[model samples]
Target: MTEHSEHGTQFVSKKYTSWPAMTEDINGGTLHAAFILAPLAMVMAREGDVPVKIVHLGHRDGTAIVVRKDSPYESFADLRGTEMAIPHRYANQRILIEKLKEDFGFGDDEITLIDFNPPEMPAALEAGQFESYIVGEPFAAKAEVDGFGRVLYFTKDIWPKFISCVLIVTQELIDTDPELVAELVQGISASGKWLDEGDERLMAGVHREGHIPVDPGRGAQVIIPDGFGTSPRMQAAMIASQRQYYNQDPELLKWVLSRPPDRVRYTELALARDEMEEIQRYAERLGFFSRRPVTAEDPFGFDDYCDPSFAESGRRPLPLQPADGQ
Candidate 1:
């Protein structure tokens, strides 16, 4: 291992660095990462920036609503008309909460959206503060194990389960460090594999010092894909639903896909019209829009969020990329 500063080290042979301590440099530097509320939101937000490879840690596979195992509402069907609470706005919890309502033909108006952060939802739910709120893995697992609530459903089952919690970079990083990026991709796969195998002791030494949220048992539930790459098949659905997110206006999926993963799958919306319609109407229920418009307010929404484009001759994927040894 090659040490950079006394604080950070570089696996120089791999062309990346192991961020010794999670610091401001990680988020503010090329090592920047985001805690995602919605996995698909990640898909929509990172649509256009390609040269930059993204890192999908495969942890944060998403969450679901769990009620006390003995609750009257046995399943999602029971959630109808029931006042359900969730943590904050525009997160996976909020998104999936509304999704359940919409799937049942109820819109945002039908159910209540409550706002609270972590520990609050679990702590409150255990005390019966609210019917149910969105919760993540381990905690979701822990809640069920602790006799808090029976799972309403695991949200990942609701969709294709796009990888969430991505590590992103600027196009400039990729332009100057394509080889470095490639090696980092390999290292991500390596770390993902290590995370999977549980080679490091559980809370013994370095792994515990590493700020890892997962235990050996829970690590199995966490996903660590080889790279930040996304399946093309998911792009269509990701783009369509993202357009309705109301965060930044929707962008043209094409403009975003102009430079995507060098290799990926593709599915056209015409075939997915029914599903798209359901999502659009779901958004409407949340007051996202009264109706789905044929075109978006920002037809070029994808390209609009660039810090500075390192436009290359070919595709540039900016999904997520972790540090070399991290």
Candidate 2:
């Protein structure tokens, strides 16, 4: 592994074109950790026996339901008899759609839901392959910015604090090197706080050199070596990097960021039992737990699969200075 940080731990970033490919690697132990879909993570741990634990969340409420700008679909009622694309059957976006159907007094058969790769959804929608698409950013943002689509609703408007993806680590890593896990959780928390701080910080992150000032008291610091969007050359590099890393478009990313502050959130990410239970309830109702039956009384073990200690530790205030003249 390449040494990417001052700390002894080496980091390797991998990209996957599809979730199943990524999940397969996680199951086979080729990948140690991932930011994975929440419902899929639960299914992996409980049903697929992947022996992983949900440590933290990636982001909240970054999803939307979009329809063609020229289309006459204004309400959920208008979606009847139309086809919609989703990232996957197990995605929370799909669950959100299901919840919409229920709340609107519509049956499952009223609207057709098809599984399509998120990167393809915008082009597919443009070509009239589907009436609408629901997905996480910046794919949904792409359609809107490209002028072919308009938002039907942002998920936050319906499900406050909606969780789509989570940070998951293998049981082996938790057992063998917990300090690393703690450090990772803290870093994620800090990064999320930085992102949610406001536009200035967000723009700095995008336009300036990437580095985390060493917490002198802590003895080691995390470093992002790439200087993205720092200049014309780096801006092009950043765009290419985002495309490779997330299949993301720069315009869409800017659009997502320029929206209301609450369009998507990164703070308040600590894993909560109530939230997990709510997700489980939805997953169960949607028949996502096919390998085994689950219920509120005897649900797939959230207590066993989720470890909030790392997030709890991450939230504790760091020391202001080095202790006793290290």
Candidate 3:
């Protein structure tokens, strides 16, 4: 009953509480497509013998490092010798922590890194089990909303354009139904654009309501009742989608919305060789690629494991501009 047919194609969505379980399903061919940690996906394809390829990205700059608000840790340097938790060893959050250690000139034994489920991190930190934890949002926002954690750094601020997850499909699916894969990529690309643009418009409306000031850098214009002025259909569709996909706790949603426009971005999701190379380099440096040695010339078999054509050719949905005279 998880499968629903749309436009003659059956779509199934599966949720997993842990990356290892999801990765197992992905490797076993139970899941055709998923959004997973970028480094983990690369390791899965190259080291774990899964025939999957990265087609598009999930989002950018959505991860953060959080410490208890009452903790004495004012900076990353203060966390030296303290235990820190990460969702997974293969996660980019782990790589970011390694980078932080390098940047702060800390040794390997300086900070103890533990693997803990992201959802349990906030509670553990509150109980003094760890000094800090880094993971993707909604979780970080959860901590802030509960008034227990304060952000030490948003990945966006430190890594700039940090990619946590990517959309990957099995190679079998790609070879058997290339058109379906193309449709999937294009649909995701368009939706990502739509979400980014709609967020801008929504933020503008929030600004007009005196809730928050619109950032001039984002070029958001003041709009009326619906973020898209005079476009009731667009407004209705956005509302419905939010109700379905983003139906999280009200306080969590509010905390997410109160963040700056660029806290997380959905645009620029197309897979780029340079970005992939960067992740591979970090993964190699961090010893995530244990199955085989990676060389500077070609790491992780990038060309064989990635197909950017789908994302490059994907059509973007046009934003609904405000109509003249209201």
Candidate 4:
């Protein structure tokens, strides 16, 4: 429960804290960077506040839209003008929410932003809390298994093929613990590789033993909700699919980079992962990489990492404007 101010950002050692502990302190590793160590981190930079030295855990498996099995509303189109349930304040939901507002002209005021949180979304939907719910994973699968409803549309259908949601730690940790950060990042990248190549039994073992509480086979990860691989191609497609959300022409991505409310780079990490080794080499080509002296030796080589001595400087949020003439 310690907080220090470093370099205009509230430097919290907690950002590097372990899983259960991180989540307990700040809404469950729901906001922790340690969980995700690589590639997925680049995708989350789509949002403005993400740190530059982020370690992505993985991508969202996909999204699912559903109504009560017997609800009068039967299709994704029915979501228009109908109240959709969601857990507000989750970083993962931000893009989806913005996309919904852009694609369907639905705004926060138009739909019910349920306070029940993600875990409760399916149950709330089944209980008639709303006409439909925006959900992910085992919860969605559980709804169908219980005969509550079926998938009306999915992220693959409405959004992009590959979407990344990241887990990030403060630069303080990267600066304070470079060696540790590298280990964590390597773990993540390796974990993804392992998940992709490992046998089903191993995957099942991983799912059962890892952070997520649900059984991957309980119609969760098994139903395609938990993706095991890090598909770089999917990232491009996701960004493309998301253009409509920002009112950017889909074709514009070819001629220009994405214009976002955030600068679309490392704003969240204290040290910026693109400054790391193999990751920087792979990511910088995509423009997510940085030109800083990146070395794999220690992620926390920076003197300012985790010191939090200057955080009270009151930094302003990054200014983000729609790319030239959206």
Clashing pairs in 2: none
Task: Estimate the TM-score of every prediction.
Answer: 0.49, 0.82, 0.80, 0.47
Query: lDDT tens string, model 1, 1-326?
Result: 11111222233221121122222333345443322333232333334223323332324334556687667987677766666666445344565665566677886566676766554566678887777776554344446555556666665466444222334444566667655544444444433333333232221111212344454321111122233222321222132223222122122222222222211112110112233334434433454322322246533222322221222222222222233323
Best model number under lDDT:
2
Query: Native-vs-model 1 lDDT?
Result: 0.40
lDDT of each: 0.40, 0.74, 0.73, 0.40
**lDDT of candidate model 3 versus the reference:** 0.73
Question: Candidate 3 versus the native: TM-score?
Answer: 0.80
lDDT of 1 at 98: 56
For candidate 3, lDDT tens digit of each residue in 53-110? 8999988997889999988888899998999999899998998899999999999999
TM-score, cand. 2 vs. native: 0.82
Clashes of each: 21, 0, 0, 32
Q: After superposition, how far is residue 203 of candidate 1 from its true place, in Å?
A: 13
Residue clash pairs of candidate 3: none
Ranking by TM-score: 2, 3, 1, 4
Where is the poorest 10-residue window by lDDT in model 3? 1-10
Give lDDT tens digits, candidate 2, residues 132-198. Answer: 9999987888888889899998989999999999999999899989988887777667656655662
Order by lDDT, highest first: 2, 3, 4, 1
